[model samples]
Target: MSQVSEKAVSFEPEEKKEKKEWKINVFAMLLVLLVIAAVITHILPAGKYEQIEKNGYTTVDPNSFKWIASTPLGFFDTVKSIPTGMVEAANIIFFILIIGGFFGVLKASGTVEALVSTMAKKLANREKLMIPIIMLFFALGGSLMGMAEEALVYVPLFIPLALAVGFDTITGTAMVLVGASVGFTTAIMNPFTVGLAQGIAGLPMYSGMGFRLVLFVVIYVIAVTFVYRHAMKVKRDPASGIYGKFDTNEQDSLLTAKVELTKRHKWILTAFLINYIILVFGVIKYEWYIKEIAALFIILTIIIAILGKISLDDTVESFTQGSASLIGGALIIGVSRAILVVLNQGHIIDPLLYQVSEEMKHVSPFLSVVGMYNFQVAIHFILASGSGHAMLTMPIMAPLADLLDITRQTAVLSFSFADGIGNIIFPTGGTLMAGLAIAGISWTRWARWILPLILIEYSIGLIAVIIAHLIGYGPS
Candidate 1:
């Protein structure tokens, strides 16, 4: 849909008063759904009930509950199941805090601003090249940064530019979210997601880069085309639904302004350059953590804040608030963990895998496991958060691949496909949520436009993995 429509909703001053009420209602509904889904999923495992009878009914062992493992939960069983997810919840909370801290530093130091500005200059000048430029940026960033949060800050920066270029906010958000997601599955050297996936799957670090690069390009081409088509559609017909509720940021004007670079902005830019140089050398010379890399950003932010005369109080508050901005995204990761803990504790995960393999075994080898890519899809969906799904699926899928005679590398590639494309569909994903929030888009609106393209690309990517597997292009 186009960005110029009268039908499109605007979040300007008048809408603000009404939106607060609607947002609360929507949030309340989502919380209810999360609780209901968790409770039902936690109690649905029946296998633990069979074990309960075998172990004697009065056993008080906390682990005996097996929430999803037991088919039906008696009232007593549900009461006892609450503690099972505590650890998972804690783990997610801890990780988010650590990363959020880095975001605070980077944003305060103006490193993020500098980076976004550099990208904006390229994008604003080369409006027609937005799709490919975004695609390349996603791949390059994913390969180096190791996680997808790199896109979170940038998504906000790009949404305004997308609107200026004649696309609606939702379409803009879709391009960033879906484009980055595609990059994730096809990452060449990402340590957090791909590196972790290979580690669990027992492959060497960075072993599949050559093939993954191919995957990156293939997915990138498709995602870019999808985004460009939507952009063109918006340009052609401004009344389309895709442009609803498009909002522009005040900072966007600074990007388009032709003022001579100020001393403070220049120092901020210089700090960013030196910090990146140090970061690159660190990554190449020492396998330092990406979070640690972001530390340099924090240092630079402080220096720039002081030099820019932004005031100590404002700098402190910005750091505090910028870090706080990540809390909601972090919370989604935690909520997603609740889903995983229930699934894992139930012991249904392995049995679920066995069921999938058995079904595939009955069919021809050529079309079976690869065709049933949805099994990987399902496993990933259960652990629906991005990096979290990789951790959950890799250890399980790797061993299963061995038993089924599927190459481990090919299975890893399938896991990538399974994890990446589905995030486009699953609204629970944090990156997707952040993208929507930044662009003022809704889950309902995004799905209508992106799903068809995602499905087509998913089918093609799955076939590509199968072809790569058959051609003997992956690790043995």
Candidate 2:
């Protein structure tokens, strides 16, 4: 009877078994986008813009756009762009890997756990305060300096912190992503976006500071409120969280246990703070970029490993494990860059920009400015780099603003609003995708959760542009 039952089970149809739910892979999605971008190249007319070097900035001549021979990517070329994109984005990829390795060393050293545990205990009663405090800090970083990709390093730290505090990963992720985004969008003194755009538009650097400051306060309030409400809701009802259960089974003991910051942990924390101080100083004073920042982190990683009293082999192992955790995010960055590669190789970016700019010319000044704002948002998907987008579009938009009787300052504002806001939600944005990957959140899930915020910010952007036009926002 047992042999007969076994034979029956072995012959059971596979279709009778429960099927696993299919989840979309980010890499597969990027591959599909690569194919779609190639198809777009075939459909759209190719064109080129004559770029001129002015004040060490290469900007396109608005009137110099002309149709060019099409150069759409073939199948092999589409596949080849992946490695090319990886090569193009090598600095960013390596930066992310180094950050992972750094954090890995930090976490392995018990510094992160000790810090999170201390914070959790200290703020157990006032845990809600964390959202505003952390968000505001990151927002200031973004507004003061273009702090986008740099914010990713905080994701792993924030995730566990949020989890420890009875909040979800989304809440933690928002503290960095949305906070920095709000500040970046406002662009009070953000050199990468506002500074570059204004220089190209012939406005003094950060000229419209007063108005941007107003926007910053207003948007920061909205962002904090949004994140705070969500955090509280999750706290009150764990099931209300987006990620369902906050699974910390592995660390449940650590989270619930009393953790004190020891002398070594304090030293590690001080080292981190000093490193950040130097990083900011270098960025502002010397304009340090990827290569410099990566090297700094490598040094910090070594110092951290030594301070933690971790053996060399263990330190190396921790670094490797940490870097390995972020490999998915690093690849996402490469794939995101590939989309731009395909579009740039096809020479359609200029044509698309020309078409949109020409379309705006036929509208009223108010509507025209609004169109320009929307155009910046649309173009951001392909041209994700703030400085690159500014250089490519500002020269054209600045003159177009003049032709349409709008101020160049408003054009710059529109560009900043679009570029900054789009960074958090856009799948094509390498930083956003990389951050999402690190947080273990799918792009679709993030989009749904962030949709309302995006809508509110978009509305704010529209109003800001309209007000800029009505009141003549200019470099005074």
Candidate 3:
């Protein structure tokens, strides 16, 4: 057996063996997409839609689409778009960096470790219950506040707890990801998606809460159940877990460690909870966006450092280290945004939107609404931002719904469902990619593991769209 093992190892150099298992870097893949988008600009006809501003929102005039001179991106223009994309996405990129830094300070304070250790001890035997409880909390956050990027802050905390409880990293990820995504999809009060789409569609803000609330329950239950089943499987056989056979020494230490929350740790955690409360309040009352949230986290990081008695130099170093670790993931966001720049520069986005709207108009009302949902899903591959997607597409979908005898509220619902659901699986989604990067999971592995759940969610979305159309789900 030893001779055979030696022969097998000697058959290939270690570097060659590593090369055989290569995976595409997320940033590189997105850069290639940028090039592809630029190439398509030359292939597709260029067009523009007239825009009108209403109540501080700019929306497209569906009837105003017209062919325009194609200005496909030159090589220099294509290259320049990378920096422009970074600039355009700077708000979100910085938000991610600040979150990383905040979490770093929090981690350095021993708050994360103590909390995980405490949770692991309490839920050691009742591990299965953690799935639903944790998922429900995240789902509520997503449903209420549109918590996509914010969810990344929890991945590091949960992964250790998940492993401690006989689950794997993917389960921990899904606890946050699948939960938030489902809530975002149901979107009972998600201002980023449902609210923006409703406003653009000219419906009363949050008019269809009853319908969406029902969806929230149904979809949330489905998501929690799916994640629970997977966790159970992983618990029974570690090899069955996605990413396979993780080292359990750290997880075992978390469970066995006699970790007690010191006075400082407790105070730090209290401040942490208060920070989130402030965030939700600010978002709801003050209409806080990325900038406000980033500022909040900056303050919280300082507070955490102070409460933990971390030195000034140590705090700065921790913050810098944390931010540096996430730079790769954050840059992926910039690169993904570059694809949108290329399409816009090529002037093909409007033409694609116009083509879909025209195609939907020719179908039956049922098919047309379903087609709208599917179109939103497909479009999400390129346009991943929730509010941005709504602002661009809802203007046309709302009017097209009227022309097809479908309700504007239904159009808004289709948009929310597609946009939220697509966030989990789409490659162009910077938040999802960044979250995966934080968890140290490759996008391909995550995609493979989550694909089944996505199919189920997409089916739910399809059925919901159909029911909305059939029942004339409309403004209250």
Candidate 4:
């Protein structure tokens, strides 16, 4: 099965506009939320501060001046974050190379294409509910593939199918986001997010797969429900128009991305799989870190390029092109990090966290963490990207969980839910951008359809965590 034919992705114009409009709305909401948060923090009553200090919370020294003293340090703070930026740049480049190799091998061997085509044939007749089916397909894909980028190959095929079935482009784009987030947030298999979070929190790798799988199903159902409701609404009221005018010329076109892979592409895929298998074993036995895994990827890229009989120049060209495709996303990530640094430098993260943490302390020790967990959930709405927010805030949060007599696992789970839910509204997310662009949907349209669903699911997730705490699933 050829990869392209196996999956029917539609890159139609209507979906793209819906995504654009949704993004615009999300950006506006995020800005307003940030401003309101800032104003509230600025006007915090001194009595609350006194009560907070009485509760043993670490008080931010108003006269200590780290926040105000470094007013001009914002420029250099970005410079300092350059190392992180470089690391991110490298990660993006390597990810593209790895993805290209995997796709190339699958396409050349006809495995991916065959699978997609076979699946499509079975699904074509069920096309009336195509959005939900595609959402399920990508959710499974994300779990099995263990990589969100894998969706990039098939989103194009799904968009057109969506349009053909009388749904607009926004519905198509939303499907991809729903699937990716469900799989990503609750993935029992993906080593990227789950692995990093566990490793950092000093938990055993893959120890919590069962717990995560449960989350996966819940998130999937929530995502599907939200998407279905919005799609139905759009169908019922076309004049209520849940989309913006799509810019059909958005650069993430699948047509331009397709390239022919030679026979050796099969060997490269084999090599890639074998390499990862070895990596899994190595991590299990030797406690390898990300840098080690990265080294393995670099070595495999070089070896596969040679075995495929591709010239170094051609290999480099392909790799460069792949890297270039990700540059836009990479830049956005860096800028977002810069904004984070600004927020942190302003001493805002801790103060707000302290406020929430203090409130949680008054509750039962076992359930006190729920409030803090919910706080993260709220923060997720503003900082919708996952790793970006997690890496920035979890370190501070993990310790607070311990101090508050909360289970770290519970804290991690809450972070996961928040991180996952945040993506539903954040317009700056790469997956959302790519999915919308391909479908020709605008951000405003997407927000109109998906925001309510995001809120509902987030609410449900909080309830679930609360239930988990009540049932003695958490530590006191």
lDDT of each: 0.57, 0.83, 0.83, 0.53
Q: Evaluate model 3: give its lDDT.
A: 0.83
TM-score of each: 0.73, 0.93, 0.93, 0.60
Pick by TM-score: 2 or 4, better one: 2
Q: Number of clashing residue pairs in every model? A: 8, 0, 0, 50
Q: Give a tens-digit lDDT track for model 3, residues 1-476.
A: 12221121111111211214446766778888898998998899899998898778787887789998889998999999999999999988898888888877777777777787788899978997899999998899888888888788787778777877878778888898888898889888888899888988889988989999998898888889888999899888876775332445555666776768899999988998898899889988998888998998999999999899999998998788778767877888888889999999899899999999999878899889888999999998888999889989988988899999999999998998888788899878878977876666777778878888889989989999999999999987
Candidate 4, which segments miss by more than 4 Å at Cα? 1-68, 72-124, 128-133, 141-146, 208-211, 228-338, 344-359, 362-367, 381-385, 474-476
Where does candidate 3 have its weakest 10-residue lDDT segment?
8-17
State which candidate, 1 or 4, has the greater lDDT. Answer: 1
Error of 1 at 258 (Å): 6.4
**Using lDDT as the measure, what is the rank order of every candidate, best first?**
2, 3, 1, 4
Per-residue lDDT of candidate 2, residues 147-195 (tens digit):
8888887877787678777887788889999989988899999999999
Candidate 1 per-residue lDDT, tens place, 1-476, comes to 11221112222211231223223332444445445544664544433312222111221121232334254333444334434443555443443443444444444444444444455576665767876777666657665555354455455445555665556566556656776677676767766667666766668877868878877887777777877887777667765535444433323443553434456667766765686667657665676553564565567666767766677787777666654654555455555544445444545554565456557666665665575566777666566654566654555566656666677777777777776777677655655654554455555556766778878877876787778668755553
Question: Each prediction's Cα RMSD?
Answer: 7.6, 7.3, 5.7, 8.3
lDDT of 4 by residue, 212-318 (tens): 67777777877787777766665566544333332222111223334344456556657767986776576656755445665766677677667766676766765
lDDT (C-alpha) at residue 359 in model 3: 90
Question: Positional deviation of 117 in candidate 3, in angstroms?
Answer: 0.9
